[model samples]
Target: MGIPALSLSGLYSLKYGDCVRLPSGAEIGYEANVNFRNSYFIPDAVLRTVAGDIIAKEVFPIHLTEFAAFGWAWPEHGNDFMFIWTQETGVVKEVENPDLYNRLSQDLGETYFGASKDMNVNTLWIFNQLKEQGRFNSDHCNTKLLTW
Candidate 1:
């Protein structure tokens, strides 16, 4: 059996910066304020091995209404995975190991333009689907099959 892992979640506003807490009882206090010029605000989560070696880092858009994008980095394997969820079309697309040049322009364009309708509230529903389907399992990451 795989070891239990920590999952962090929280809400942040201008008044209260990142108030997210990890399952281990550690908290991520405020760090920086959001910039309106930027198109996305990515909140991050880290997963470490039992020995304390960082295994993976996950980043996702803080606002569900914005373009649905999630990224995962595995330093051990030198690999990265990116996923974009389109609200309008209800499509989830993957851009494996995207590079700096195409990461935003091309991939994000495909995600945003491919959709036919907006999926504001449904973004959370999709996240629940991933969680329910065991996408957060350590085995999935260990086998390089990160589903979420």
Candidate 2:
């Protein structure tokens, strides 16, 4: 972005004397930013260590495709995130694989479920049901996962 009309040099005056001058810090301002994380794609290592065993038995079938992030959350404060993989914390938006979602939705015909609301429940319920059917047994990534 271009500098705003008023910046360090314009906001303050620096007078140079015969042998004296303003300290280096007093003459300018600098700010820089660098982001290293992607909005999506949690690293594989994090998923295994942070919450794998627990998720395996409790939330099977919904194995993480990749990546993870953790934080404290509360439902009453609207800080609780959905317990399903999402592109951008989306609750009902299309899942990463629409084919998988369609298969699950079709399989669960009339069953009702949700997480915070109906959509997430439906998705989670599908995951459980699919797991029961062994649909995820040959998942490509799972075959390569080295338990940590």
Candidate 3:
């Protein structure tokens, strides 16, 4: 997607800011603010679709596979849970292991990893499905998920 251009007047009307969460869960304030000289227009519906697609992908792991089940059930039930696993850990994308991916996809069904509508809210559903199948350990990292 391209950067959106907003008209000077409309740009001035935009409510640009951020809601920061403190250690005590308190909002701080918004960041830098500025006014643009030109205005670029985009339809609200188009914006919503684009935003929804991004939310879905971000919520759903493109690469999902099945592995050994742990003592617990397949899908773990919790408020923030996304997927369940046994002992597997690492990248969950197809590029990690094509053969394993194919096998898991066959066993679980293609619908397991399709486009989602409300990923932020539905991630729990995906996690539940994974747990039900006795497979969790699945993970996703954009670029190897390097951490300090």
Candidate 2 per-residue lDDT over residues 41-113, each given as its tens digit = 1111111121122212122222222222111112323333323322333222123455644443333223222
Model 1 ranges with Cα > 4 A deviation: 1-16, 28-31, 40-78, 81-148
Q: lDDT tens string, model 3, 1-148?
A: 1233223323523432212121111111211122221133211100001111111212333222223111111122322222222123322234446666445434432332312322322333443443345332212211111111
Q: What is the TM-score of each predicted model, taking all chains together?
A: 0.20, 0.19, 0.21
Please give the CA lDDT of all the candidate structures.
0.30, 0.23, 0.25
CA shift at 133, candidate 3, in angstroms? 19
State the lDDT of candidate 1 residue by residue for 19-101, as single tens digits. Answer: 32222221222222322222443322333332333323433321122343333333335455444333332222245433542
The whole-model C-alpha lDDT of candidate 3 against the native structure comes to: 0.25
Error of 3 at 84 (Å): 10
Which one wins on lDDT?
1
Candidate with the larger TM-score of 1 and 2? 1
lDDT of 1 at 38: 26
lDDT of 1: 0.30
